[model samples]
Target: MISTEYVVSEQPFTVRRTVKWGQCDPAGVVYTVVFAEYVISTAELFYGCLFGQGPQQAKDKYQFGTPTRGLTFDFRKSLRPDQQFDTEVRVGRIGTSTYQLLMHARDMEGDTVFTACLTPICIVRGQRESIPIPEYFKEKLKAHQTSDAP
Candidate 1:
């Protein structure tokens, strides 16, 4: 029911990280959970590029950061320490108070090490209030929308 193909036409966003010893297991392969962290990291970078240095700026205006409410990852391959991986993030679905990010990790050879979709919701933690996405974000997101089919 969901589209699996990556919509490359959307603005390409990327962040790179080298596999650290602490992030790997005895086998040298990166821990499974770290893959998701890469997704979250790059998504943050995406927001920073669009709006400001961090979500706090947006939160000041919109009252919430993008908090991951759902996550799904498909490990196409494994990544080992001494190797570098870059996370590619793409705008998926943008809504009034939520957005979906399509994220992937690729190795030096261009092999897809992992792929995932993360859905983040805007929520004011203490008050437990959810606010609509700000107009500024919507306008910035338009620059990253896909014009071609994935």
Candidate 2:
């Protein structure tokens, strides 16, 4: 008999994305604002990968929330419709209640398309109050932290 299973990859989390026509403007270039959505979506997937389940549910079960503290992007190559890229996610600075997710998007030719840093603070879920990073969550992030991460 054959079985199937899913495991969290030891390497950094990565997602492949293709630019669809709908994601472009009349000029056929990806809209500037849409890149934020791509970064956020990738972060959610990274969290889900760590927990072995959906990210929101895992956050809810832990009674904590990760709300964005800051988001910054550095655009390199402009991406047009039909262009494919890959985003690699890495854990960055982790503080008492805040952590950073650094994402790098690269084109098929190995050129950087964009880079983003998403900083989210841990809070008591639904309470609007900051909280320390949960032990298990911290452990998972540490496992995938970047070499320069603190």
Highest lDDT, which number? 2
Error in Å for residue 116 of model 2: 0.5
Which residue pairs show collisions in model 1?
A: none
TM-score of every candidate relative to the true structure? 0.82, 0.91
- Give the poorly placed runs of model 2, Cα more than 4 Å off: 1-10
Give the Cα error of residue 62 in candidate 2, in Å: 0.7
- Residue-level lDDT of model 1, residues 55-117, one tens digit each, is 667666666666778899899998776677667776677877877777777887899988888
For model 1, the superposed segments whose C-alpha errors exceed 4 Å read 1-11, 147-150
Worst 10 residues of 2 by lDDT: 1-10
Give the alpha carbon lDDT tens digit for every residue of 28-143 in model 2. Answer: 99999989988888888898889999999999999999999899999999989878888888999889999899988889899999999999999999989999999999999988
Cα deviation of 3, candidate 2, in Å: 24
Q: Using alpha carbons, what is the TM-score of model 2?
A: 0.91
Cα deviation of 127 in candidate 1 (Å)? Answer: 3.0
Per-structure clash totals for the candidates: 0, 0
